[model samples]
Target: MAVRKKKKDRRYSKGCNNQALLPRGSKGWPMIGESFEYFGAGWKGHPEKFLHDRMSKFSSLVFRTSLMLEDVAVLCGPQGNKFLFSNEKKLMQPWLPTTIAKIFPSSQETFNSGNSKFRKLLINVLKTEALQQFVPIIGDVAQQYFESKWKGKKEIMAYELAKTFTFELACKILLNIYDPELIKYLFGPFEAIGKGFLSIPIDFPMTPYRRAINAAKFIRKELVAIAKQRKIDLNEGKATPTQDILSRFIVYRDENGEFPGEDEIADQIQGLLIGGYENMSTTCAALVQFLAELPEIYHGVYNEQTEIAKCKAPGEQLEWSDLSKMNYSWKVAREVIRLTQPSQGYRQVMTDFMYEGYSIPKGWKVYWTALSTHKNPELFPEPEKFDPSRFEGNGPEPYTFVPFGGGAHLCPGKEYARLAILVFIHHLVTKFKWEKINADERIVYNPLPHPAKGLPIRIYPHIS
Candidate 1:
């Protein structure tokens, strides 16, 4: 919470160097800062409370605070969101907590400087043409996944089950690793990694941080082995360069004509899987939770999906064409994500700058929260209400409804995530009707939002 004092230099006398120009908000407790209060609100399932309370008290669009021992400015509303998203690498730079580097040491450079290149690679693989081929493939996987894990079950934990579906899909579509045993073995470490990202960075043995580091090592070693064999297969003409992301990364060279090392490739693959699985799985779970609560909305989605289903021959999988017709279903999914955005995006100040007359000091962090913007009555009327119709036309203004972020930092795998979600919904609505087992399941954020009881739900198969 310590703000740098004015130095003898005249330039330091102005802008953020002058403490008086700093945003108005308490840093909370020393060292611990407002970390507890900030996260506590999220854990209570009202993350917007933390932002709204401060906004009301300060009467400002920007406020200073501290979290994880770093000073921050919590930027509010669409203007703040636009500034950060539009000024990326200019006024602000993407940042990861120190713990992220400690956990995945080998890929630190990739996470830092090479992130754009990594994103470009992902966009190449997940582009529309590439994803068209995956629609039916994802449908086939979702069908089998539902039949085995969801079919004939009276009640099931939706969030936990959704995690399985997303992880299996990541393994299948991204790495082309379809071995159930290997996928199951890989799942544990990935879960540990997710839990450790925002945990205390103390690396003491048995701590979440230490466990995550060890888990990263285990996953990296396994991925390296996989990448190495993939390289051999590519050289022997047994595998095509475009076969899967694993093969693509093994064969891909940067603009400088440098191919990533096996260890680095492994780290990047792990990053992609972590990024892909966590948010998408949460979206899938939230979709289920929302649909269960609103039978009318669920019925609308069912009608839309069933209409698409009626066109397909018996046992025929969903096609790319069918996905376009899933307009209403996508809107429902969009609303789910808007109301329950996984986590706020973080950016580091690239240089001292003035925003809304408040000085943002270089080296400090900035947080543009989706919950605040998403739930703002100004941007979204009855923001607390579940209204899929809000997304009917052009949708909530450009930067106001950022579920996958915006501009350059926008999630590269957004298309793929959409495809995956729609496929799951298509197969789900067409096959079964489900209701929440717990009428009031709380959502908790372990840095990522998840239903507290894993969103258990009862299912009933539709009559043939």
Candidate 2:
């Protein structure tokens, strides 16, 4: 892949010609060089300020440095996202390659092996039918956690609790791993692998990158063992190959009637661990924060749950059929995801592309910041306000409000994520009434966006 370079123009060295491109930063650094000191200080913490500075300096320009070996382009407004996301073939792969690749190395190979077989397997398993089977399991797991861990608690760390819950749920659904002790052991390496993904990819001794590599190795070993055991069980007929996500993958046959080997299965499982849990857990925690701040929304969700409770028999559990009646809850959940843009859409331009009279040279890192696009006043009026009503009549543009991204690379497990979040919220609202113990709680986006402080809330059980 050849790196794109900006053509020098001595006429506009001091200032930008286009007002639309003003507010960008200076293109002083060499191509592929790192301003590590500034980046390490906190690039994500102050995104708005950073973007403003960059925009002021360059004015719709891409800055490149050889030291860092990456191109940085600040995509602003709705048109920018459309041009980038709509052209999936030209710009499909994400920008955080090192981090993402480190987390799911096997998936990378599977992805490179022509058709994304692992991604297809994930879609087959996590789609509408496959996910329905896990609802009961997810609900039971959440209820147990709430009963055992959060009983009689006035306040709790929302992020930590959400992470633990989603992690356990993901393990059960993806790998069929249910042992608590083993989960604890596995989670440590998983966390390390996640950390390695975002850090500078240097394999020096005692570095985060090296630790992440070791963690990835440990995860692969564990998953390979599990896959082997699963295969043995399937061969022995000890386990009736049910329609779980992993089982579906195990039985999946390609054009040649070939199933993926254990290593490939391990890669997909690792992909689910990193890609599935972090985003959903953050969304879950953020949903709590949104509800805490907006009492009306909170009440609306509770009322939906109440209505569902009435439709059920004395002790009937909530099922997929019941989700239809919870319209308001679903809207609120969608709004939460829309407002809290957990991840950015990243891609590299494979060839020169033109948009709005500007040329996006090949090999440049082109990205669509979901935060900026989702906050577009044209698409989302009062963009900062938490209004679920915006999606009432006709929703925003198709590619504009993409929380799971767009095109063929759209998240395979999006449906599973939605169900898990809905179930968790339903349980929270049905079981207790919560009020924010701390009035001033904010979200922090690092590794992934999450509530900076554990959302501490006072919960009182509903008395009917």
**TM-score leader:** 1
Question: For every model in order, what is the number of clashing pairs?
Answer: 0, 26
Please, what is the TM-score per model? 0.94, 0.85
**150-236 per-residue lDDT for model 2 (tens digits):** 778776777788888899888888777789999899998877876666677788877888888888888888888988888888888
C-alpha lDDT of residue 245 in model 2: 64
Quality of model 2 by C-alpha lDDT: 0.69
Taking the tens digit of each residue's C-alpha lDDT, what string does model 1 give over 39-69?
8887888888888899889844888888878
Q: Runs in model 2 with CA error above 4 Å? A: 1-68, 74-76, 90-96, 99-107, 111-115, 200-206
Q: Which candidate is the best by lDDT?
A: 1
Report the poorest 10 consecutive residues by lDDT, candidate 2: 14-23
